[model samples]
Target chain A: MSKNDKKQQVETTGHEWDGIQEFNNPLPRWWVWVFYVTIGWGLWYTVAYPAWPLLTGATEGYKGFSTRGQVAADIAAVEAQNAPNNAALAASDLATLQTANPALYSYAVNAGGAVFRTNCVQCHGNEGMGATGYPTLSDDDWLWGGSVVDIAYTVSNGVRNESSPDARFSQMPAFGDILSNEEIANVVAYVRALSGQEADATAAAAGQQVFLDNCSACHGEDGKGDRMVGAPNLADALWLYGGDAATITQTVKNARFGVMPAWSEAFRDGGLTQAEVNAVAIYVHQLGGGE
Target chain B: MSQGDTPLYAAREPIFPKRVSGRFRNLKWGIMLFTLGIYYLTPWIRWDRGPEMPDQAVLVDLAGRRFFFFWIEIWPHEFYFVAGLLIMAGLGLFLFTSALGRVWCGYACPQTVWTDLFILVERWIEGDRNARLRLHRAKWSLNKLRLRLTKWVVWLLIGLATGGAWVFYFTDAPSLAVALVNGTAHPVAYTTMAILTASTFFFGGIAREQVCIYACPWPRIQAAMMDEDTITIGYRGWRGEPRGKASDPNAGDCIDCMACVNVCPMGIDIRDGQQMECITCGLCIDACDDIMTKMGRERGLVDYLALKDETREREGMKKTPIWRHVLRPRTIFYTALWSAFGLAMVFALFVRADIDITVAPVRNPTFVTMSDGSIRNTYDIRIRNKNGEAHKFVFSQTSTERLWLSVEGSEARVVEVPADQMLQVRVYITADAGSPAATAERTVLRFWVQDLESSERASADSYFTGKVR
Candidate 1:
């Protein structure tokens, strides 16, 4: 290598590594030209995009584009793509939601779940498991019916509320106005006995006749509450008001009719859209209770 | 003088590759036919995978996150199989390079085959090497213009076909082909085709040998992969050193004929020591052998030989079989690595699950205290059904005997997924009141989704969080 270099007399950087001299070389013209093109591209990129920091904000490039705007556009595109499915979900019945198209059903359920977390969970308890006076929606029983349309109607109109004029209406007629306090207590015992709860057998035996004569008109002869009048079944362990003797006595004295606010656009407080209403209704129905 | 005293870039000298017929040429023709045939026809072959799945025998379904190759189907979660195949490919390249240097670049590389075809078209239109040289040197004329235009158009059509065959691997070939013809395909498809066509035309036609010489990094790096035992085209310098014209009595076997130089695609003289630009194509050896046969001398004036063999010949040793040079430790190591990757990938492909499930707990308000004093948590369960048929899966949770699994609006606690699709369902698992697991602050809940019609099952575990109070 030294013999050849002596003959060629090529200039070097005068640096040697392991007897090999370093020849100072210039960048290839093609490489230099490409490097210039890249620098030009970089300048153009900064001018055409949001760049350069300022005291207030970055300089808005000529395009005036921001990642925020891009994200918003992306979101809008997704929503637009799903608009028809959303519309179908809004109009679909529960069977169609559950069976015909699981994708749409899944959309409604997820949307409904979100709605539940925001609004309905406050009254219906977490996971729609109602507390005390509020109904346990996760049960297999319902005051009216657990069907999807029934749940939709109930969610939209509410129960005996001022928001919807078509709200579920029923009155126990305040039987205490006619019967004595002792009579109310005896009827409570019989109602508890029908649901297989511990009760005074003697008082229950006497209350059975009283129940047949007066209460059976709406409560039925067997003490199973009627659905037409929006009455609850006394034969079930589930109690809308309560199963306790004291609570039943109080309910008989002045009827228990809990009110749920209307959640439809036809009601107050900037009610939900039809889609949102359907979502919450679907959510509640899926809470292990819909028949 | 400064290093910049001389120009940094040298202009490309034209290479007029004269046509030669030999065993190597026939082998190159056979290889090009096989590889190009596979590239263009693989997408059109149909493999029935039932109704809801794509039938393309070899497809990379990017949107669907699937790769289908005949009897094998790969999902995104099983991407290690693809990785394994790529590893195998890398090892295979190493194995072949150790045995025969730059064999891939010579006959099988897309660059070599496509450039050869484009050159063939040019020669057919403009005549052979001398005719082309003459035509290029001549002033522009109607005849020259017509031939140039005709050759370039053919080249462009070949480029278009090359690009057209590539897009079919990503979608249903017949439908995509129709859509491409009608301009109804996705804009990206057209953009990809245009870019590919442009690159093929520019690289295979205009760039030609310049790409192998200046642009490609392989020729620069491939020297590192070779050892002295690796077979390459070599000129028998010992026998051919004393050279002259055919009429000179002092001349050795090799006359001063430049047939080897003219026939070289790279336009480099093989008589010089090996250089980085050599692709080991053996065409120069073929050219010299024909000349040697005509001169009534030995046919191996330039031939495929290893450096070790050359050394042995210098030491007056007898020739050894080719296998003695090929079956060395480096080739054996590469072959072993290639086999390991291939075997591992095949095993993984067979054992991979067609159905997979993943459950993630909703962390915002992670646990909900039910009215009955039990704690409940919801999960987003994503089910990927890779099978060709739809399936109904029963989802059940474990970690507590009293825990109940209920799907959204589904009283049956089962989920249904379409063939080759993913379905995400919101699931609620509620612990029973007064249960030990419900009262615990945290517990791992395992949710198993089982196929109703098959024995396939996949399970995912998530933490079921609750407050101790």
Candidate 2:
């Protein structure tokens, strides 16, 4: 390289003892311009947004934008979109709601999936498989009734609750005072035969008249049970009290009444809207047995 | 320029940060892999917490105000556990810094890791130091534009991922991922992503070293924490001075290779002295050693050494042993302080209660007289249930006045409270009027609540009163 070609336009720090040399050049033009632009941008940002904290809160800047306000607006927008389907769900009856609007039904089912996971998964298994005491919602047989209206009614006004006037109330009588031990055993045999389970033929034969005289008032003579009274159908495989002989005998001797505190009074008195209850009922209904 | 202007020293130029390879680099790579891997994978793991609770292994349910780890579930009132974790982190940082200077800052700091990642992306798209410098000096071209755009896209994606991972800590990760891809994630997620993306671009991409040197308080605080005995990345002036190139055969051991300057991320020549921007990352040591090996010179031109030992060597004092300097009074004190805080936090967390109570008295009209010659007072009581079941809160006050307490709105004394919900009730207390005297008598009234089935009893206290009779 020629000496003139190496004439350094920018002088170095000149104390270089090795290949490393410090250039005394000014800052690059683009970098300095960008630095200025950034400063200007910072000022603009401070003025246009709530950047500084004040004694009360933050300054309401020119744009008046906030993280909270933005979030609220976004949530409202999404809710507005879902409002029509929610309205349709509110207007229709439970049975008609499912069949009339396919889209709404699909949406409700999807919505119910999460709500069930949140609320009903505790006692009723995650998938609505019953535990020892908890009744399964997935089966066709129900302690109450399986019809959509019946299911909805039972859910709204739970069993054995005096607060709701319409709750299907039936408590098996405590026959300890009325019937002898032998009679209680005979009745257990009669109940077993009614369900088509194993039973002593002779005792069941003698106990048929006893059931006709006492149990037929709530439970029909055919043992089909009165839905209004919430007596279980003795003919069905499902047993509300129990199928085992010991449990059956004990139940007959001293009644077994499981209390489900009224949910309607709680929901109504608690000031929750019908839509909210319906949302929850529909959620619970879909857990196992919903058609 | 005047003599005063030229008197002291030159402002340090940016370190061109040359690349190097060694055992320390390998260790750093290993740690980076392990930490980043854990962060990305931890959210997807599931735990079978029965059918009742959420299944995500590690989740912070913001709406539920519950934190779920694999086995331990934390409620809002039990926030001491979180505080304990933060305290442990602080202590751990102190202990680590006391042993090795700025090691955490150099390697594990989020800023450092992200900056390293940004640098990698920059290198991939814009080429390394010399190539970048040449390109910058060159006029703008279509090729340069394409490279710059590609680099920005990658950087933005990394920023989005960072924001994405952060939101996962607040919600269920897999569900959020699905929601995000389906455009169903909360708008807050998008906003957070934007903010994070901008920050990553500014901090990691542009203001890299400025954050460490001028903005961060850590380097300033660390100056006070360090002492003469602390091991810092230092150039051995005793061996490296009288600097000259190896071509000049009579030069000192340094050979004036400039390898150290080339490899420093901050661009400061280590031979000048330690500066605030130096992260003590030991890259210079690696660079210097490589040069030394190539030049047939003994290594360690730049090494981790104590200031006292360096000074002693300069003053012709006998060289002190390495182990003697490590166990100083400052390190011992720091260790003790760190442990004390750690142990105290652990102790507090274990004993902290899940349930907390706050009682408010109706102050507008403090007392009233019933027609039956009884004094009455009203209280608004709130009960919160932390357990996963609806509980019955029974009302009975501790006043010996046969204080018949009854809730006004509900008939039954037993009130039902849902899981993780607070139930507020207005309770009225009445007593035989003539038996109580004075307006401001302080009598502690106890309210006991039992989970009827679980037999778990929780008690709270309030006061009973009557006007002067």
Candidate 3:
């Protein structure tokens, strides 16, 4: 009962260092039980989940849980939930989309933005501000058209590609084989003059008659390129290729051939679905370009 | 000592503090009523925040990612205000602890308040100290079982109410109360209530002072905040020494009465001097004062005394004034720091603009050469309207050189932003061909959005990239 007697009764570990002796005290019973419970939980967890790696794959535990499988299931669930909306989007008329069904229009735009970022960003840029060769979708200039229906058709069939039979097709003869170098140079001067760039006036006047003789069929008599033929307007400041004198001369000689692949699943393998095509077309149309 | 017999842990010895009445005890009761009343009643108070917002005076709307306190609404981006408040709370604790010792631990701590309530319930059902002690040691009988079950049920109800009051802070109190009674609340709500109830019951009713001594970090931290001038409860060993019966003329003013020990919540003998286990609740002071009055002797045998004052009093010198103990440099510094944070937060809250704008220029294909020979830069401009009603915002540009500003999807450079919503629009700033801005590699520009209704405006500075001509 005495304090000194109680101190003397306490046990110490058999080892001593200098005058210090380690007390041989037991851990708290609750802590010891919790440690045992954790060990049991670890064994159960290993049995219930994929834990060990085998020769070809990991062990398929009782629960058959895999993070990869879980992620795939989650994606599938979301896709299934959106199936009705996607179906409605594919069937909705693009012209009446904004007025008749605003919710569907908003959904299409958001969905289309996602699709465009994944597939079209490489050439069209993140905000659809096209690169030098690619046509900018955010601008008012359009070679074919800029309407929602027009954009949808262009996106589905593409331009001058062999993948789709209905692809917008246009061909300009390589005038290099017919016209002399002097004649090609004069026509380049006339084309530059049409776009309001500095050019040789005499050579441009001479080339105006030559333009009427050959290029007028596709480029129109006024040098305003026809959209039906998918010809770019020479008078516009936008150019698919460079509008400098040298670049103009090269274009008049060899002509330009831009090929866009079809995006519809019916036209190519691993292509976009009808809903995805509509979505992307709506997304591109809303980028300030659609007329 | 033998190697196998040493004990590392010991079971807790339960404390049964007998009730006492005095000035400090009355103050503690008043504080308990005020704090508990605020906690249980705050969520039920309503304020008019218009029809579009929740009316709760205080709400943590996790679903909306906002904290609504009276007229102030905090967005996630304004989390620094909450952080400032928390820092102020910490400094306030430091100030009080350095000035008056563990006053927070003794009177205002949630653990102390709830434990006091639980002990009151126990005393009501099982009788006070001696009766409760007898009940604890007696063999299990029908009468004991009835009393124990009654006490436990009341404690459980108090715990339930504590947990129930907590959830009302997150949602509308009346609706959540209805849903709770109808068994229609969210499963998470039920789960949170259950968890809080269990913790309250265990910590307040069962663990009591053990939570302060073993679990809480505040008691350990308070040691660093206290110095010689800090006022704390202590036994006047100089006055009450040579303890004996009242009739003993040789004894000092001290009759060896155990009243102080009997009323201590931590069950420590105050006559043994200051120890870390003492929360300084002053219940012992109350008990000793009552005993001293009965014996017709002077009181303050156990009282709040500073370490320096103890030494001065022992040497027969006058103790310093109470204000001298409180107005020291450390407490003043903590008070100043706490006030600075509060004032800064208030200034920021009042000066914050209702409209916020951010401009992020498209980096890939930084500048586009338009068909008209003009240079164009695309920006993803986000405008946040914090107003209660929609307003049309006129988008304009200011630059050193001439530039044309246009908003996508609108003919005029105007956008109608919905109230309390953020709208992202594609903005185009174009420089005419051969213009100074077009020829420059980069042109500095400020994009401004002015509310058409109120003329309130906000601007963000961004640079437009041009083709290096």
TM-score of chain A of each: 0.71, 0.67, 0.91
Greater-TM-score candidate between 1 and 2: 1
User: Residues A167-235, candidate 2, lDDT per residue (tens digit)?
Assistant: 668887888888877777787789888877899999998888888888888788988777767676777
Flag the better candidate by TM-score, 2 or 3.
Answer: 3
After TM-score superposition, what is the CA distance of residue B22 in candidate 1 from its true location, in Å?
A: 0.4
DockQ values per model: 0.08, 0.01, 0.35
Sort every candidate by lDDT, greatest first: 3, 1, 2
Return the interface RMSD of model 2: 23.8
Candidate 3 per-residue lDDT over residues B318-402, each given as its tens digit? 9899899999999999998998999999999999988889999988768777778888888999998887678799999899999
Candidate that beats the other on TM-score, 1 or 3, i.e. the better one: 3
DockQ of 2: 0.01
The alpha-carbon RMSD values of the candidates against the true structure, listed in the order shown, are 8.4, 20.2, 4.9
Interface C-alpha root-mean-square deviation, candidates in order: 7.9, 23.8, 4.8
Superior candidate under lDDT, 1 versus 3: 3
Off by more than 4 A, model 2: A1-291, B1-16, B47-53, B57-88, B247-249, B313-326, B393-396, B399-401, B407-412, B437-440
Sorted into a CAPRI-style docking class, model 1 comes out as incorrect
lDDT of 1 by residue, B237-285 (tens): 8778788877878877778688888888888998886877777777888
lDDT of 2 at A70: 100
Q: Report the lDDT tens digits of candidate 2 across residue range B1-469.
A: 3223454664545434556777566666776777777777888889876555678889999888899888677877778778878876776766666657788888888788788778878887888778777776778899888887898889888888887787887787888899999998999988987898889888887778778987888778777667777778788888877888777666678777778887777768888887887888877888888888888888888988778878987888876776677677777777787788778866776665434445676654465544233566667777776655666766666754467777743557777776656777667776665564323465667876666556666668888777663
TM-score of each prediction: 0.75, 0.59, 0.89
